[model samples]
Target: MHISHTSEDDNLKRLLSFSAIAIKSSCGEFDIYGEKDTDVRGKELVFERTRYVYNDALEYFEDNFLSQITSLGISLIPESDEDATI
Candidate 1:
């Protein structure tokens, strides 16, 4: 089935873009801690790895989840103030 892009799709893309920006800004860096190796005495050696959280998140959204969502041709149009009941 061929799905045509509409104004709703554009709106959804804008929303997604804005959300990604927010996520990137808030999650700038993260501390990743894990066990790196063990000594001869069986003592575990721990390490702290600093990574850019936003880059990882952006990669995931663009390379993985976003592709899937686009393939499914799903779009969302948020309700405006005029449509709000309360």
Candidate 2:
């Protein structure tokens, strides 16, 4: 899964305050959490099932989520520190 900023503003203040989408996949549940960007830093998951479910859920999210955000005129800014695994 990928997460990125979607605005022209790049300052840490602005970027940190922006809202971000968080996805959580469990054995029998797929959930999304939207919160301020700063809240996501260093967050980690320790469940084995989460990794498996995430892999499946992300395939669906990539196919469906990108178009939805693009249609809304949101431009995704890639994370400079990491490469997309997918």
Candidate 3:
């Protein structure tokens, strides 16, 4: 018997799906911080943590989840710290 393999296999699809979910979750957290962040220093800390979560998820997806697929691209994360605002 033989098997056929493709880039968008089941495991790879699951990985991409999970990454997308995690990134969305981080975005939600960023929004919540925007609402609840009152103090200047506290807000800065919140923003830094948000940045860490966003960038960490983005990098993890790039490093681990993206090597298998060729045509698919997720333009999920903001490209710059300034754009990361809001």
The candidate scoring highest on lDDT is 3
lDDT of 1: 0.30
Model 2: per-residue lDDT, tens digit, 4-77? 76453344323222212232211111212324332222122212223334455534443444444332222123
Off by over 4 Å in 1: 1-5, 29-86
Candidate 2 pairs with clashing backbones: none
Locate the minimum summed-lDDT window of 10 residues in model 1: 41-50
Tell me the tens digit of each residue's lDDT in model 3 across 1-86: 02277744665445544544554443322332344332232334333334444445544433453322211212323367547674
Better of 1 and 3 by TM-score: 3
- Candidate 1 residue-wise lDDT, 1-86, digit = tens: 12376746665445545554443333321122223221111111001001112234444443444443332222121246326745
| lDDT, candidate 2, at 74 | 22
Which candidate, 1 or 3, would have the higher lDDT against the true structure? Answer: 3
RMSD, every candidate, angstroms:
20.7, 16.7, 15.4
Q: TM-score of every model?
A: 0.27, 0.21, 0.27
Q: In model 3, which runs have C-alpha deviations exceeding 4 angstroms?
A: 1-8, 29-86
Evaluated against the true structure, the overall lDDT of model 3 is 0.39
